[model samples]
Target chain A: MPKSVTLKDVAAKVGVTSAAASMALSGHERISEKTRAAVKQAAEDLGYVPSSAGRALRSQRADAVALVVPNSSAHVFGHLYFMHVLTGMSTAANAHDAQVIVSTNADTSNGGVAYERVMRSRTADGAIVTSAAIDDHHVEGLVASGLPVVLIGNYPHLADAVSVGIDDVAATEQLVEHLVTEHGRRRLLHVSGTLDHQTGIDRRDGFLRAAEMHGLTDVAVIEGDLAEESGAAAVEQVLRERTGDERFPFDGIVFANDDMAVGGLAVLRRAGVSVPGDVAVVGFDDFGFARVTTPGITTIRVPAEEMGRIATERLFDLVDQRPGGRAHTELGVEVVLRGSCGCDPERAAAPGPTHSH
Target chain B: MPKSVTLKDVAAKVGVTSAAASMALSGHERISEKTRAAVKQAAEDLGYVPSSAGRALRSQRADAVALVVPNSSAHVFGHLYFMHVLTGMSTAANAHDAQVIVSTNADTSNGGVAYERVMRSRTADGAIVTSAAIDDHHVEGLVASGLPVVLIGNYPHLADAVSVGIDDVAATEQLVEHLVTEHGRRRLLHVSGTLDHQTGIDRRDGFLRAAEMHGLTDVAVIEGDLAEESGAAAVEQVLRERTGDERFPFDGIVFANDDMAVGGLAVLRRAGVSVPGDVAVVGFDDFGFARVTTPGITTIRVPAEEMGRIATERLFDLVDQRPGGRAHTELGVEVVLRGSCGCDPERAAAPGPTHSH
Candidate 1:
């Protein structure tokens, strides 16, 4: 391979001091435009490469931030859905002339503590934390350390920390209301994540609020772990327990996320249960595959990428020590109407006997 | 937040020189076991966080490697499947006491030129290149630079760089053979990726080879960009051109990846085609959602995470100037039979179909 061209080469070619060339390349106002142009031309000619680390060392900022998630490394690549949020953050960061460092806890053993190591050691100027839990000690620690940190999800007590997230409760309420009033569905099953998580808690509260508003007090709730298997297992349990009900146990189902909803859809399809005809379903987090599924999935669309970008930008603002900045941000969510809910006008208007709430 | 404990604090607590304390914490052979234990105890008591970057600088190594993909940051995180591979690399790297830097040239105006910038600047000690094409200039340049580089997929005419990839051709051949011989599939339709990409070329080649071996020459091939939209578009084109044939144009369809296959499945289902009964379909890269979908997709399971780990280790080995190492590695792939391609009797007879291939 050819030897890399150094700043020295550019300086020599331009017949200027290395300091002058550096200043010119950095676009220092003190440098003359003619000398800056000369040095730049020389740099281009010689293919002089600038070192981000070196520049960071001199400037005391790397112009890069780390996006830290807590999980085993293997899980990072295998989970394709995260790619969307990551893409959004990267695009926004790049637009700001910054780079991203993706890191996770060393192992599952340490959990939140591993993040402490990254922050204490100043691995990156700031960090964006995703999939954050309500009692995330790592985030609390980072906030206490005066580090610039942004979270993709909200934690109730971390009022001092910058965060960007969807209003899960409001979004869930919207979906439930649509299913109950608009679709005229009475019996409903809510497949949800562990209630301890903020997302799960908020979504469940929203569903309950909607049920109360619509006077549908007898809603069945099944706990799931936000995984496909969990959804399938929950469905199986529901099916077994609802043996001799005169009215179908549930005419509508709402899943905490798209993955679980999809799983539930699969189980229902395999059992020869009619979707939207016998039952209607809605999911949260409008994932890419939601639309591709048969009958599609009516769901709440969380602006995943936008949330990531905003979170990162908020962290950068903190890193830059912006004054009088607030810590919490809540992004918007939308209800997407699709085939799975059987709400298509044609399907709803069909002449066949229709079940009403 | 409380101030982070530093090396000085550890040394003060241990009643030893900072160098001695550092050596003890590093587990250097020069330090006595008793001294190491005492130093470690002191560090633990004080909550001293060792600096990975500083330690790497002292050791004349970065203790970090870069996983470089020639895509934008948004693209990197948009796909959920990549999370697993990234997770695998991170987990393995952490096991070896290393960190990973995920770099992309997605925004670079000049194609493949970012590799030159990264290498010339020595931003990473070594790098793992994923989804490499046959004529990838980045691989060629890295090889020429004598850098510790590993390719996750095959690259043409580059003999000196280490590679870790599945045999795309063989895996595709096995998938096709299973469809033709066991499932009685005929008139195959192949949905392939862009022909320029190595994986796309090899998979297409394997499909054709299998067809030749089975004495089934009546085959149709459609090109796609290995995305859900591409898959949907390809299926749409095929359906439009079929001219109402009584026999379905193809009894079996093979897709480049799960994303495309899922898209194609959606289109077919919407058109009232019974999966596996009227048409059988197979996808590559058995992603997480493949099983959760109705009629769970049949696919070729590539060891994405394992390959990532192997590539990272090999890159590190090369960076460390290890002796007597080969320049390439071929990882294995397996065929996963699921409901989409018709149930596997053997699998059905066994415990469950949930096993990873």
Candidate 2:
């Protein structure tokens, strides 16, 4: 198909100039009817497909997929969650016979030159965007440009955007229910991450709603950044409140994320507080460390890797022009029950002589 | 400089064919003496650098650095250590205004078409290879092709290779000393990764050497495939031997990597073995999880990120034609004392109710 037919081939068969034959075959009005008919017949006889279209389908493709993390490289690289996400993408991409190129979006600070060039580079078939950052403009811009994009976050405003994510609110609600029902905790404290991010808002709201529904009389919420230090500090604040007021009762604490949970556990340990026996603790984000931290942290597994795989598959569907390519996918999160929520005392980790690495 | 002086400028001034002017300026004898002299004088007067040479440094460049992980993509994306390495590369690449392209050498299975194309693709100026796989031919091929290359592991066979890595043997020796002198652990067992890889070989040799030097009578080495399951099975074997003979006494165990160590810890826990009380365990590779594990896994930090950064810097040196690009660099490792080594009995982890995630 590539070398068998050319303009010259048709022109030679038609006994006309290559330029004239090209124009005639393309139905240019300037060419004589006889000449145009002859050129068209010659083209059909030679089984010619347009070079531009053929190249667009084959030679022009970069055969690479872009994984866009719309956050700082530090954020993406530091968290194993994102690494797991990348792992899934790599696996799916490998199956599709394509290499995935990571776009950390640090270059967005440089007028988004890198992503803009990615749009232009025909080698990159499409992009899977992890819109972890607040700014949606970068993602919106890509969608606006009609580039095939599958986002790994919930963006309600971008109604047409294809997305894959878990229902953070529901997941948090289930976690709170576990505390109230399974652990039989009446007094509860929900320590939330920064409310600026969507995840923080969803989980916080979920916690409050769950507390109200359960008809728990002793419950409170505290605002803190998602840093582990914040978790430790929040725990101290709780202890101080309980000591001073004598009415501030709390038996179970829920950390916004596992990092914070780890910190809170450290503080609880130093203070000689018996976990589950005195104050039950639970965390979110089932990171690898969450499971191994003494009494394993019963947290919400965000399906981060699965999100990556599904998003990539959806993006490829769009790239491949398949049906339902732009469908919104809502993945479910699992409540990984562990010792933190006082599930099973028998599985509690044996004491070791060290607290942290 | 880009727009001010071009080949056209020299061509217009010299009043000769571009081919003739280009050849003359390059000292090609095909051009007549008068033409050559005129072209040379015009080039000098115009401060013109040959387009070919100038573009070789700028326009023809991909302006991206390739990170070649000569291992399966699963091996890389599955491990946070590799992610941290990528983070370091990303940070350094960002500083240099170059984006990093991760090449998970799985394509090498398909005849290395991807990396071979990377060599031909002018946009990728240089490559930093993590020679984790046993095949040195892939690395040697890149070196032989004259592409600027820096390795992140010791490659003694590639004499001219620039590399950055921690001394595994020395690190292991120090780790062994900690268990022997600091913790007073006499009978020991070393769980080594598969010997097919260099890391496994180095670490095993290090463990044997350290044992011989320390003069510990009860020392044994067990080989595994570097999987957590292998470590678990190894622990079970230790328990079985002890149960049957009543003489296979072991006070401490060293795992080749943290994943195995975590596994072994779990096995010990289920067997009702007391960590640091009955058996002190240690691991290599200070993965983030190493610190947070129940009794906290004592580990040797591999300096994965630092190695990435140094290797990248050295790669840029070769690409930029700077001095001393191909020098061997040995980075140091750190021994993190934790509960597993019984370093701080006062800091034993508070027991929890759950086990592995």
Candidate 3:
């Protein structure tokens, strides 16, 4: 095989040291603009693209980010949440001329050992941790190890870690407020996600705070694992108990996420409960089908994709040793009103020809 | 930095040449078992992990696979199909002691140039192309360049290419036959995905052939973009046309995928059409929400994850120059019966509590 041109050739052509050529080619601030231009032109002229070894040796970068996602059996691969995040992360990486290396774990206990090896072997420069569970010790270890890490979700305990997350607490509070104020909803039920993760806890906290603010004594909370099965099961128990004004009359239900909300809506529909007319329902993380579903689900449109994009960009800034300005960013969310909520049925889409029955 | 230990240090300690040490470390067949063990022990003893540069220079392999998914607006991130496939692909790579580098493209016109650099720079060893579009000329260019390539979906014209895909034709055919034999439905409407993709063409062909076999002349077809919105619009238009025995007694609707099917179900329910009663409905690619949806969507369960896993493994086999037994793998799909189909409403979950209105 013919010998390929290398950094040495470019250096020689530009009459500079190999280190100078590398720095200039990499656009180092220390290198003069004149030298940078000269090195780049010479590299192009000589067709001196860095081989894997040359690139690895010269830049000392993998140009890759490891995205560690939660591997829940039901939600991880089935729900649109992670998919949207991954897509956004991938898009951001692509735009930045980097690629994403994805790894899935229910809890990231083994993250450190695995990610340490990843960094040591030059498989990736840094990692973006998507799961910000309450008991995520491995994340603390990753931060302690001084490896550039960016958390995709909020971790209350690890306040110092770099992160980009949604305003889960405020968003949920807003949804609850929407139900209480405009809809005149007093007795309520919050179908919450598990308390294991920061999102669930924060959202539930938001619900309780909102409930207290409304001074509603007749309120209840049911824990769901953020899956449709959990939501259906929870609602089934409610039906079996013969829910009505005789007991804790829940005028409205607030779901921690859209998945559970959709399930709740279906269960309520089957039971002959009229949505909005009887029990108002509102959801979080306005999933893709939210806009199109029957009764037109009222929801909070979480910036899942934006979170992924920002987290990725933050990871790159950390990996490249640049000051990324903010260490934490809490993106804003929007409240979308529809037929599911009693506030405004006008915002819902026309049921059209299929509304006959 | 305390001069981190290198391959040279390991070799010196093991009393072997650097080449021998590298071969032993990499588990090359040329290296004896004793040499491999000794090199490994000495490297461990000295804590001599190859730095990023050294690993690249010695192994000459990135040990990563690039997964290029379709960057469609609606389905790519929102649907379960892509997420499940990605999760499985990532898992397969992890099992093989490799990592997955993800990319997205609607059309792969720019793939060759990007992937050409990816390989040349040792960013990834091979790529798995998920799109099997009829006009996928970049795939042809990739094949011509002798790069290790694996297509996740089937393309009939590319007979020489390696691929792993579902038996789309048989799966769709079986679905249509079920609608006829079990439901005893003569008039039908097949909602098809876009014809630009091989999947769409084959599925549409399957529906047509099944109709021909049944000798049903009252069947009609509606074109969709494999999106919920597409399915909703098509069904809406049908409803507006006053669909009945007058125009064409369409008793069942076969959706190309679950997203569209879910959309169709909502439109029908709104219009007072009872599923599997007034008109049966069946969907393809049993998505996550299929089981929980009211009336339970009857659909085909495509091995999306398996396809991704198999395609990844095949790409690695080709990259490692191993003779993978089969050049193509068409995984079998199963027909799932539920309340939406005429066969076995018992199979549907007791959508208890929420069937009232």
Candidate 4:
């Protein structure tokens, strides 16, 4: 056991040629970036632990990672928030002895093509992507094919690739300031889904900047595909705009998740409508059927499997070329309080509250 | 593409030495099973299609597959039946340009030690496993480490591996003959989850063989771990064995899933009972919170992402060694109806009924 370090001991401490120290310790582009930093500093001065079977025989790296998602986002597989971010990216890629390989998109407009043939057959070492869309040429062909891609949400025009998200504009401006200061409410509506998804354009710009810091002006948005029959057809198109007469009555709705707030509380219980006494319902991703639905649902939680375990541990610190953290990570959001936002009906009819989020 | 037959043209038509035709076309144990079937019959008589970079430069095949599961199956990531069998095994491993990886178990008592270190670092070319238990030395250490494992559920004492499942004892005797001949319900209970799982011993031997083929000898059983707080603590231990007087009268129960029938319908809606009027519930995996739980449970659906898309298309037909199918496949199961097994209270208070499941 004391004699293990090979690639001929980092090519005899970098005097080179063990196929140039296995193509400069497998970063490979036919070596020379100053001999791949002198065969990675002679494999960290000969500790040489590179055996994922010698990096899958010099750079075919099947330690696996992939994730990908986007089969044209068909409600991301009936969302348990992408199955708790694929079980926190398979329990942080099984605590780093990695393997996650999800892949889906049979061509979300050419974005996955089996995730660009598993990163051109190197067969995966990095890739997280999740439903990315802003200027996404499949995340610009995985950052123009250089590889180790990350992007779970924000693109910020790919400035140095990696990403991870949460601040859906300050958790939809603290759930629209708890529906306008602890339920005083105002004519807000939202609904949303396909604003070409940057989390539906930062939660419809945090529900119009919390209805313009409370000077509320009858907000009303709509468009949905984040299905629960598109939030019960946006509450039957606002009950045919209040029985064909522009009564404009939405005293608060929000949605954009929790399976469209359990289809807007079963279309406001088949239209008798009296949640928070008439409308107030919020939702984001406090999902497990938002505490078994019947009157419980005021949400925002969103640590969706801790943003899939910190975006696969920041794409394995950008696939082991680790450096500093925060390559734009975000995560942090929670609001909770249930009983359709009217307040805690006995801890919202109990069941899942062992300190949520 | 016509000139793609490489490995030095099948080692110059098998006269050998292209590194012994890349270790006898990668079945590698340092060659010689009669030179690995004559370099796979001279690369299949020169048609030669091997290139996942020539099978990852001779079989370090990160062409990926793994799935695994068992991190002590804590309701397998809030089960949408394992996210529709991981989206039917990632759409049949993205139609065979393969890559699926999931993995999970960071030790469910060694039943997938990170899926046997991603198949001993060959970085996965086989393995499916998901929830298998009976005699499972983590699926007999993946069929005695010969690799290409398949399991999904069933052990049948390993007899030459490959498993795939469904038919949990004839889908629990067609859900206990629809609760004893279409809701006659002669005293049954079940609940189950931890019968050391071969799907809780084939749904408790299909509920005691449909209570001894309906001769109805008051059945009971209990155990649970398939959480919703273990079916709300097995309905408070059968309501403390019927208010402490051993007055045993359980109309019908069943459970085994749908997160313990949504915690046994919130403990029969906080004990007022009346589901199918005083008790009748059935559940197996027809989850999407089994149609927004109020009275909508009547269950047993399980195609669980079409048995994870036919056990990952028969583990990609045993990772392309391809023979015909059946190494114990199983599939087919559906029962569905609603209103807590009584029958359609207006199609279970109508919400998701476009024929669910």
Going through the candidates in order, their DockQ values are: 0.28, 0.16, 0.30, 0.10
In the range A253-275, model 1's lDDT, one tens digit per residue, is 99998888878876776555667
Say what the interface RMSD of candidate 4 is.
13.3
Superior by DockQ: candidate 3 or candidate 4: 3
Best by DockQ: 3
- Standalone chain B TM-score for every prediction: 0.85, 0.79, 0.84, 0.36
lDDT of 1 by residue, B1-357 (tens): 244577988999878999999889879999999999999998877767765445533554556677776642233245654565677677777876666666656546533356556555555667777766666665677777776778788776676667877889999999899998889997899999878688899999999999999999779899987888898899889888887655458889999888889888767765657677778889999765566555668898878778887877777677766763666788778888887787753322221111112
Q: How do the residues B199-263 of candidate 2 rate in per-residue lDDT, one tens digit apiece?
A: 88788888889899989889999997677789999998988877664533798998998889988
lDDT of 3 by residue, B1-357 (tens): 123467888999989998899889889999999999999999877755567556656566667788765443325554577776776787678777677777665323432345555654666778888754677666676665677888888877887788899888888889889989988988889999989898898899999999999998988899998887788887888888873544325788999988888888877766667676678889988766566555667899988888888888888889888988777898988998877875654433333222223
How high is the lDDT of residue B80 in model 2? 78
The CAPRI-style docking tier of model 4 reads: incorrect
Q: After best superposition, candidate 2 residue B148: deviation in angstroms?
A: 2.9
TM-score of chain A in every predicted structure: 0.90, 0.77, 0.82, 0.36
Per candidate, the number of residue pairs that clash is 30, 7, 12, 2
Q: Of models 1 and 4, which has the larger TM-score?
A: 1
Q: For every model shown, what is its TM-score relative to the native structure?
A: 0.88, 0.79, 0.83, 0.37
Model 2 spans > 4 angstroms off = A1-60, A71-73, A113-125, A244-248, A320-323, A349-357, B1-58, B71-76, B113-117, B120-123, B244-248, B349-357
True contacts recovered per prediction = 0.33, 0.24, 0.36, 0.27
Q: Model 4: per-residue lDDT, tens digit, B36-113?
A: 797788776764544454565455455667777765675565567777888888778777766677777775443226
lDDT of 3: 0.75
Output the TM-score of candidate 2: 0.79
